[model samples]
Target: MDYTIEIATTDFITTESAVKGGADRIELCSAISEGGLTPSMGHIRKCREMFDLPIFPIIRPRSGDFLYTDEEFDLMMSDVKLCKELGCNGVVIGFLLNDGMIDKVRIETVVRAAYPMEVTFHRAFDRCKDPFIALEELIEAGCQRILTSGQQIKATDGLDLIKQLIEAAGDRIIIMPGSGLNPANIKYVAEATGAREFHGALRSSAESKMEFMLPSFAAIGDYINPAIKENDVREFKKALML
Candidate 1:
């Protein structure tokens, strides 16, 4: 069976690492620790120019909740437009109503705005009121894929639902499992869920190289840098083949 690996890259450096590590696609973002946000134009432009891989920049405007105010939604629209203009392969997005239902009307509008670029409704699907209902709605909205953890914290823990979702999705859309997945368990997820694509940060961290540091700066939590390791990314792909 063929498998595709998507690496969530937080910046140009991590993006490079993912590519070198053989990522089949890139989910470009900023502030991945906050569960990903829209990356800057510079990051988008440079990656589009340099990489031969598909780059889908996440179109999220903030950290918490899939529900957004009108102003925030506008920002997301602008970001989506910018990604297309910069030649990104696609955009990742999600929106939810207060009751945890997908905001289908708004999502459809965003899909229209995205035009030729494909859209993958992000994990906000997991936060929705119903998985099966949202799955059909996303398909109707023209999303090419849905990145989900099957409404659980980790895709592994949600294998039963993930498998069921795969069965339910059929050929209507691609269901990619993500969150807390790594090289070690990717094969298991693939076999269990019968999914062809997978997503992960696959990150490793290193302390700052700076020799001089302010002692008080430690309070802000900036000492370590997290990034997708090339070997780790390679291992994820390798595991799928094995």
Candidate 2:
């Protein structure tokens, strides 16, 4: 019953708000709308200065698939080193083969580079051909946790498999359900999966305060920036309490 909620934060504002609203930890990233990419070094440093909670920055080099080229893999290792230099508590990472299996060699190398810091294999596990086999591979690679939606688009839709994964994981690894969680279904997920950790964004949008709205021009890709609302984070935590 003593579960923890980790907020997926994109910037300093969301980081502060999530901590204020009682987020136990933070998964810092950029471009969350595109499934989260590695955040800037300045963002990681600023968050370390601003909060006392554990920070785990995503180590993905790009937005598309978990498969990476040798150069991309090198960039990811450098990012992991940078996260450690910034005093981040951990890093979230995942890599796969073209055949849809865990990239064991590359993953082990990355985890070794991360060193004493905790590492959670990200949703790339969902892309694997077999969840059970990938689960064992992650454990062998020394990951502390796996953030997954049971290989489905949403965790709720994969509740049965999530429960099975939790049961299979036992004390060997932590299985944290993420993707598409909200206040309404968090309780159900907790009860059904018996998981001790959960991850969510709990984000809402607010329009920019620019006086002159560009009727014909779009400066940024998005009109309304997505941010983590304190109330929504609080509500998600409250649901876990219940």
Candidate 3:
């Protein structure tokens, strides 16, 4: 199975380390603690200079709801275009219908904006009302890949369903299993589902980038909570080695 790491933050130094540690590709974003948001142009540009691996950016504008207004849709399109200009290999994005189906019109609009670059339908797939029905919409929309958790919390817990999706998708689109994937469980997920790709933050909660030294500082300083940790990747890979 192919191992993929997602660096959902603006830290270039840590992002580079992920590239060096045998990562096949990266999904770039920010604020993973809030389930990720679209990263800045400067962060994307910096990572582009640091790594030649495929850097597929997460095109989520905010973390809350997937249903977006026309204006929000416009913003997503603009960001998709920017990612293409910044040399991203592909983009990870998704939009859902009010009834929890794939929003075909919006899908076409973003896929069209991405143009020559690939589009990965992200975890929003798990939210769909029916996996089988959603599969048709994703394929019809010309999505290159779909990152799903087998409609569960992790691939291991949903391995049987994941296998079914993999078989059903066939060669039409990639079924990349994401969410709660770590080194220890990668082998089982790969074996059970025959999935070729995995996605994880590889986070180990390393010390905060900033610390609060004062007692009166009730605001609890340190704006960035997701400190970058290389060991998370290292240990993850090590577990996979077994």
Candidate 4:
């Protein structure tokens, strides 16, 4: 069976590593540590220029809650349009009502805006009051896929729900398992959840190469950076096949 590996990359370097390491697709975003924010237009354009694989940029304006004000939702809409204009394969987005239901109306608006490009509702599905309810709602909203960890912190811990969701979805929508997935656990996640598409950062730390460091200014740069290892991404894809 063929499985798809979508590597979540935060910057140019890690994106390059993921491509070199053989990611099937790219979930391009910024501030992944902040749970992923919409990447800058320049970043989007550059990635589109450099990579041949599918690129789906996240359309999040901020990090805190999934609830968005009208203004914030408008911002998200603009970002979605921009991604389309830049020739993205798709865009990942999510919004929730205060009552903890899928914001289907707003989500539908985004789906329309995205047009020919596909939409994958991001992990905000995990925060909804109900997963099954939200799953049906997302399908009704016209999303092609939902990237979730089965409402858990990690796919490994959420296998039961993930499996149940897969059964519930049953080809209606792609339930792509994500969050805390890596090369080490890829095989188990695939086996346990029966998920065809997986997502992860697959990153390891790399130290910055600056020879001179000022005592007080040393805090400016993260001397140790989180980066994708080409081999780890390769192994992650390999594990899915096993």
Candidate 5:
């Protein structure tokens, strides 16, 4: 079976590590703690220069719900255009109506603006009222893939539903299982869901390099740095072989 592992990267450091560890592609984003927001133009350009793998930058304007305001939608469009200008392979995006359905009109607009660049609907599909209905909408909107956890917190927890989605999707659109995937469960999720593409972040906690400790003030809340470990990435790829 032909399969590819996409690493959800937060910065250039992680990007370089993932590439070295054999990541086929990267979903470039910022604030991965908030479920991934759009990365800066500089980051995109730098990654493009640094890696030979495909880079699909997320187009989310902020770190909140999928229901975006008009201004936010405009900002997302600008980011899409910028991705195209920077020669990105694709753009990851999603939008939903207040009624908990796919925003077909707006999504179509964004897809049209994306043009030759591929579009992968993000986990915002999990928030929709109906997965099957939303799947059809995304396929109609010209999306190449849908990254979802099958309406659950983690892909392993939603294995059954993900299997159904993959069967339903067939050859029309790629149903990629993501969210909370790791080396421990990647093999199971891939075998169960029968999905060819998987998305995950092989992250680990790294202690800050500060010898002097600040007792009172904290710069980044608890000072715990969550970074992608090259060993973890290699393990994840190994799991795919199993």
Candidate 6:
């Protein structure tokens, strides 16, 4: 395929919906509000049964940052083993130093643990104090692909850096664009970065059963401007067609 549409989804329902709406791959996981975390074995199994597309689980142990402790690294290793056993197509992970650099040691440990399956470095690369330095480390660490927003608040905002990264990658690694990708600009982002892959979450919050219980609902970025908009999967696909 010339274009790959990657949709980040938490539950099986979301995964199924994405595939039906034309997503090519699914980054299977849960607790997306906290970024993402490893999906349960049951969730992975359900997704594997439900869709033919590749499912890559997010192996992040916590949400606040990309920095991980020794305990967290061990947890990630264990998580990768379980993900492989459950037949996940790949695993997405990243680890960083306190000063915002790739933790090559931890990444190596994970790559070793996830043997035979593909590995993707997640947005943690965006947090790296230095993208160029981190990209080299990831290449050395043997990560096959990286999902980044060009280290900007939005992918569009970082178009220039993304272009440079794409040129620098030069087929040695995949530079998947994610974060702030929407139908309105996906085509533009792809053209600018020369990336074949795209990643985003297509979601809509209907009235939650417990809306009035205490909290109404959680929005991905702006809580105060909580306006419900259905996930824009089809729009993205349509843009890709043009």
The total of clashing pairs for model 6 equals 1
Pairs in clash, predicted candidate 4: none
Estimate the overall C-alpha local distance difference test score of candidate 6.
0.82
Question: Model 1, 1-242: lDDT tens per residue?
Answer: 88888999998989999999899999999999899999889989999999999999999988999989999999889998998898888999999999999999999999999989999999999999999999999999999999999999999999999999899999999999999998789999999989999999987776788887787885575777776679999888999888
Q: Runs in model 6 with CA error above 4 Å?
A: 208-231
The clash count of every prediction, one per candidate, is 0, 0, 0, 0, 0, 1
- Tens digits of per-residue lDDT for model 4 on 1-242? 98999999999899999999999999998999899999999999999999999999999999999999999998889999999999999999999999999998999999999989999999999999999999999998899999988888887888999999999999899999998998789889888888999998876878778897675766775577779999999899988777
lDDT of each: 0.92, 0.91, 0.79, 0.91, 0.91, 0.82
Q: What are the models' TM-scores?
A: 0.96, 0.96, 0.89, 0.97, 0.95, 0.89
Q: All candidates: CA RMSD in angstroms?
A: 1.3, 1.5, 2.4, 1.3, 1.6, 3.8
Model 3 quality (TM-score):
0.89
Model 2: per-residue Cα lDDT over 110-205, one tens digit each:
888898889999999988999999999999999999999988999999888889989998999999999999999999999998998999988777
User: Weakest 10 consecutive residues, lDDT, candidate 5?
Assistant: 215-224
Tens-digit lDDT track of model 6 for 1-242: 38988889878767777877778788987888788888888898888877888989999877888777778777888889998898888999988889887899888877877877889999899888889888888888888899998888788888888889889989888999998888989989988878899998865654444433433334442233211133467778788779
- When sorted by TM-score, best at the front, the candidate numbers are 4, 2, 1, 5, 3, 6
